[model samples]
Structures are given as structure tokens and as C-alpha cells.
Target: MAEASYPEDLLYHPEHDWTKIADGVATFGITWYAQDALGEVVFFDPPEVGSSVTAGQSYAEVESVKAVSDVFAPLSGEIVEVNTALGDTPEAINDDPYGAGWMVKVSLSEESEQESLLDRAAYVASLT
Candidate 1:
């Protein structure tokens, strides 16, 4: 399992998703808390490129040793790229949820929605 971390540069959602915005694209992934609860990831089927994803919606599915969980979108956007490597080694989601475990890169559709996302401090507070 990876060490617990909530990067300061990323914005977090109450559902345990995170996004790092750069330009108009944002990279999305589940957080450490999320993967920890789900246990060792065994499968991940990502959304197709160019698919539209709405903020606060499930865009993909991840199967873990413990259970399968929906991977949520933290921002509304069109998927531009997906981490294809996860299909071969899903444990990356458990080992590095914030890095190689990142699920997708999206061309964000609604910038204003970002205002509602929490910072690392606030997200950690919400956990307790």
C-alpha cells in the first residue's frame, strides 16, 4: 500500500476523487483513502477517449480484492487520455493512487465547478 497523501496542488472531492488542473485539462484519480478502503486493485476498465464525463459522476469501474467501486469524476470534461497501463497491473492504483494510478486526463468543460472542490487541508479534515 502507498503512504497516505493528499497533494497540496490537487483539488479533492467529497467522494475521494482528486484532480490536478493545468491549462484547461485536468488529470483525475481516486485518492489514497479510496484505494485503501477498496484493498488491492485487480481490474480497471477505463472510459473511452472522447467520452463525456460529468462532475460527481462515475466514469469507470475498478475491481479490488475487497470489492468493486466506481471511480468518480471530479470535474466535467471529455476524456482525452486514459492510463492504459492499469489494465495490465491494477495494483498501481493501490501503490500510487496519485501518480501512475491517475485514471484519465480530461479537457475540462466547466471551470466554475472547480471552485467547489476542496484543498488538501479541507479534504483531510472531512475524513475525520
Candidate 2:
């Protein structure tokens, strides 16, 4: 599993998801806390590229040696890209939860919704 970290550059969801937004698009992934909690990742089931994702709803699932966990969308959007690499190298999620482990890229449908997400400080605090 990845070393514990809550990157200050990304926004967080209470469910342990993170978002990296830029120019109306965003990359979504489970946070460091998530992969670590799930143990070694072995599978990633992603939504299709054109599928719509709703904030606070599960858009995909990640399976670890311990259990399968739903991956929530932190904002409403249409999935534009999926990390296909994870299909063959699921261990990347455990080795690099924030980098090669990212799950999808989406064209945002509601950019303003990002304001509701937690900042790193608040997210870390919530964990305690």
C-alpha cells in the first residue's frame, strides 16, 4: 500500500476519494487512505468513457485482497478517460495511489460542486 499522504493540491471526499480539477475537467481516484485501508489492489472495474457520473455516487469499484470497495465520484461529470493500465497492473494502486493509480478523467458537468469538497486540512482532520 502507498505511504499515507493527503496531497494539498487535490480536493477530497469524505468517503476517501480525491479530485484533481483543471480547465473544466477532473481526474478522480481513491486517496492514499483508501488504498491503504483496502490492502493490495487486484482489480479495477471502471465505468465506460461516455458514462455519466454523479457526485457522491459510486461510478466504479476497486477490489483488493481484503474486499471490494465502491469508488465514488466527487463531482458530476461525463467520464472522458479511464486508466486502462490498472486492468493489468492493479498493484499500481497500492504502489502509487495518487499517480499511476488515478481511475478516470471526466469533463465536469457541475464545476461549482467542487466547492463542497474538503481541502486537505479538513480531510485529514476528518480522519481523526
Candidate 3:
């Protein structure tokens, strides 16, 4: 089956995060389908801004009524910013996972890792 939902502008990870490379930084967020599957988000434990994060490593956490889930880094980088809004209004994750609900922005320490991540179509294909 073909993918019903995949943003052409974003690169994706098998872990369900999406990255939008802008400027020299990459803005990232959880995909909509992932937010839905996680249920309602109530809290986020994101990495501190300026911290170095390694790809495929646990760098953040998302908490819902049911459980807390770890968010993995899709690429190695130093976090330049985190969505402070999610701290107060975690439900924004469900309401606008791709926009205002974005989790972090990082200055990529290595550009080569981007090639290893999936494009939108591949991400959707993996979901199947």
C-alpha cells in the first residue's frame, strides 16, 4: 500500500521523528501518526539547549497519561533550542505536532548522517 501521509519537506527516522533542515540547524518534531499512537502527551523531558546529542540515542522523553516514552536523536548534533511551550501545554503535541509542537532545533555536528535517514516516502513505508 502507498503512504497516505508523508511530508515532502521533511526527512524522517524509523523511530518516528521528523527533521526539517533550515539554516544550519535542523528543526525536529514527532510525526502526527506517532503522536496519535502515543495518545495524549502531558509532559516532555527534552535535552538542555547546547547539549550534544548522538544519533539513535535517547535524548528526550514524552509523557502521556498511559506512559512515558523516550525520544531518540535522529542525527548527532548540539541542541540549540527546545520547545518551552511543551512544558506548559504538552497537549500541543497532539494538536500541532509538526508546527508549534516541535521538540528541538540543533546545529548539526555532522552532515553525513542526514543521508542515513529516511525520506518521507520511506518513513511511511516503514509504518506498514
What's the residue-level lDDT of 57 in candidate 2? 98
What TM-score would you give candidate 1 relative to the actual structure? Answer: 0.97
Measured with C-alpha atoms, the lDDT of residue 109 in candidate 1 is 90
lDDT of 3 by residue, 24-124 (tens): 79998888778888888999987899899888888899999999898888888999999998989889888887788899999999988999999888888
Tell me which of candidates 1 and 3 scores higher on TM-score. 1
TM-score of each: 0.97, 0.97, 0.93
How accurate locally, in lDDT, is each candidate?
A: 0.94, 0.93, 0.86
How would the candidate models be sorted by lDDT, starting from the highest?
1, 2, 3
CA lDDT for candidate 1: 0.94
Looking at model 2, how many pairs of residues clash? 0
Q: Could you tell me the lDDT of residue 109 within candidate 2? A: 95
lDDT of 3 at 16: 89
Q: What TM-score does candidate 3 reach?
A: 0.93
Q: List candidate 2 stretches off by more than 4 Å.
A: none
